[model samples]
Target: MRSNASDCDVLIVGAGIAGISMAAHLQDKCANLSFMMVERRAQPGGTWDLFRYPGVRSDSDMQTLGFAFEPWDDDQSIAPGGSILEYLRGVIHKRGIADHIRTSTTVISADWQGDQACWLVSVEGPDGPEKVRARWLYMSTGYYDYDHPYDAQITGLESFAGTLVHPQFWPENLDYADKRVVVIGSGATAVTLVPAMAEQAGHVTMLQRTPTWMSVGPSRDRLARVLRRILPRKLAYWLVRQRNIRLFDFLYHAARRNPHMAAEKLSEGVRKELGDLYSPEDFTPPYNPWEQRLCLVPDSDLFKSIRQGKASIVTAKIDTVQTDGIALEGGEVLPADIIVTATGLKLSLGGHIKVSIEGRPVNWGEEFFYRGCMISNVPNLTFVFGYLNASFTLRADNTAAYSCRVLNHLRTSGTQIAIARPPADGLVEGEPFPFSSGYLMRDLAQVPKSTDALPWRLNHDYLADCRDFRRNGVDDGHLQFELAPRVTDQSPVADQPEMA
Candidate 1:
């Protein structure tokens, strides 16, 4: 530890579900280690806290999304944002993880101090800027950029006469009641907002250039409820979680294997819900199912809204944003008092933090992922990487467990640093996630290169990843562990050096 710096065994950034899960795992597995979680926002619930748009809910099931350590026992598998936030808060208090969280603190940068074998993390808090040292840096910061969402460049956007809101930064109390609302974009946010705002607004219209695949399912999991009634709590959770994983995997794989068949089934579902109201042109997507994220509408809320004539869908290209309304390419004007931009989010890796190895900045695109946990050649830093197709927490739990294993291995081996050394021709130019969403496509090159094989590849298969991490122990010979350089001078200058 450096003489001038306060030291912690682990420094976790982002107090979201991932960060909280990691903290819980660390406490359970590495009892002797000291750790702290820093949240950029004033509150702790990450996504749940930030996104306050009406009808905000989880796209994934709670059985799979919830941490295995602290299982969600709710009957509703598809939970509302407030419910999920409450669940996270409950987990924090129950696990005594609240004390470790430092809110309203932004981690600006993390620089590796080679001499002292620690990360000098620069963070901006309410008081001011300060620096702290950590032996290992665990990043749970999500992929999206918090400060800036994806800027959807719409022509004549400044000509809007009414309130323009982005779902990312929803206004506190803007009266949309009796106002004709037009939500642009057919993504998850738009799907959620349409039905929610339709109940109150005069009329709600979903304006999209392209249609997205939507799936409808029951709000509560019947199987999970039955199992919970018959089996033990932990056993019920485990069983339901595994079943959901297999079901999700099967559906995703089936959709890819037989896209036409899968598309028909999805279309049938819409027809069942909307009946005569379902328009083939408006409801059907151009691409195959699971090509992009499939929007989930619990209990056909969106369809119900449409059937009741509260909401409507307009599948057309926007010609321009007029002061009174949006003009379509075919000269159709849609009157809207409020325009909601439910476009997408911008990708930012490592929470937009400037990460450097002893003053040398890391090029993530050039590096390979070490079992989807750590970056290759980057020492003493692990990440909580989640899955794209499946529930994020499934992989987050696995990554947390793997990180703990690495921590234990280091402690047992008396090593100060652990770096993953990639093999020759390791950097293969592949997609980080196979999804072709516009937001993901825009910044694909900014993230790490995908490898072709295990230990380096960030595979989307949760089951395969789980098996590999379990079977392949820490001593795989790929990781190089070394004792840090001894600082004999004990001077602050010798410990922390500026980038050359």
Candidate 2:
């Protein structure tokens, strides 16, 4: 081990939206606190850098997707993938965030030492394995696995002659122009890929085992454009952000309250766009709206492609992967030059980094989510998990703000740790996530549940969280703050182990 090792007051894992937001917030709110961000990848942009698939874009609007402190001045509300990546990079450079980032550093495990009241994070950096000690640990790693996408098992895939591609690891030089492309999946990736690939591919076919509800709307935000023209830039951005927030909340709530009406409205829009091409059997999903996230298409691009005969949707089960294309259950064959599996991502927390206290492994599923940020009984740690019903950044920003408050409280109280102590009465168990999205459903067992009470429950309402995070105090009774006893000169050397 090196004589000198990196240590910080706070160690943030993952340099994605959450990590960047937390770092920026800590810098602004707790300027005196030393912190560093360790990202597994070589770059700062997490999702934007990871997914290089064609037609890759945010399912949510940029007004809400962009950081709260940073105003998105772009005319288009649904910005392209490249624009989002640029925005993330711009924030890092503009705020001098890169100085605190250690890219290509993967955190393998984090062990919290009760004696030291600090976490020893094991990370594999470019120089090899190293130890980093921090007074507090912030896990900003998102809920998906970056190393591998969800692998869908298909029969006879090895015998297929066509090129197979997954959107997660798109090839730069792979040619699909003027070639038959078949996208297998009915999620956002499939919806986005079919339309984008149709522009150049000879023809694109979306083969789905089940239908997913998709909403079509304009790419540009009319309200944002008008507000920008009439109002100051900051004011306009705030108004648009709030406007979109309310709009999304209302839509999601309405969908849950009245699925039949929501389904009709969603199906009607698709029918109107496709006209004769629309099939109720294919467009109408078995599940209600908001059961899974509604895929948003900008400018009706997917529908336009369908109408132009460049793209088509097929609702069927794949029986086998033929040499040239896919064979359906009923013996229907769809010839393809390339098969793109737009299957969803594999869900993982903290990029699959193992967390422990001493030597005992932490089972996240047993703990309650404290304020949707900190885990119950976990000291000096917070996770940035976004909302399922609204823009992800809404929750991201709130989590960062709340984390800053917690840090400030710990400093003021002369405490080294702040852990949530469950009430005498046990918490009421609830689902980890509100929605039943395939990704969440597939990995539900791994996620922790939320309690029924305040400061522990996963409140999906962003407005509630926004107000609570901004106006609420950090010394809530649920959180117990403590200062670890100082080590005396006569203390045994083995009592405090050396870092690796």
Give the poorly placed runs of model 2, Cα more than 4 Å off: 485-500
Report the C-alpha lDDT of model 1 over 99-181, residue by residue, as the tens digit: 99999989888999888788999988887788888988999998898879998898888999988999988989879999999
lDDT of each: 0.87, 0.87
Best by TM-score: 2
Q: In order, how many clashes per candidate?
A: 0, 0
Candidate that would win on lDDT = 1
What's the lDDT for candidate 2?
A: 0.87
Q: RMSD in Å for candidate 1, one decimal? A: 3.7
Q: What is the TM-score of each candidate against the true structure?
A: 0.95, 0.96
Summarize candidate 2's per-residue lDDT along 1-500 as a digit string, tens digits. Answer: 43128988889998888888999999899898899899889898989998898989998999999888999988878888999999999999999999999999999999988888899888888998888998889999998888788988888788889899999999998899999999999999999999999999999999999999989888899999999899999899999998898988888888899999999999999989989888987888889999888889889999999999999999999999999999999899999999998888898987788899887888887888888898887888998878887777888888888888888887766567789888898888866566878888888777878866567888888988777766658887888887655545676433542211
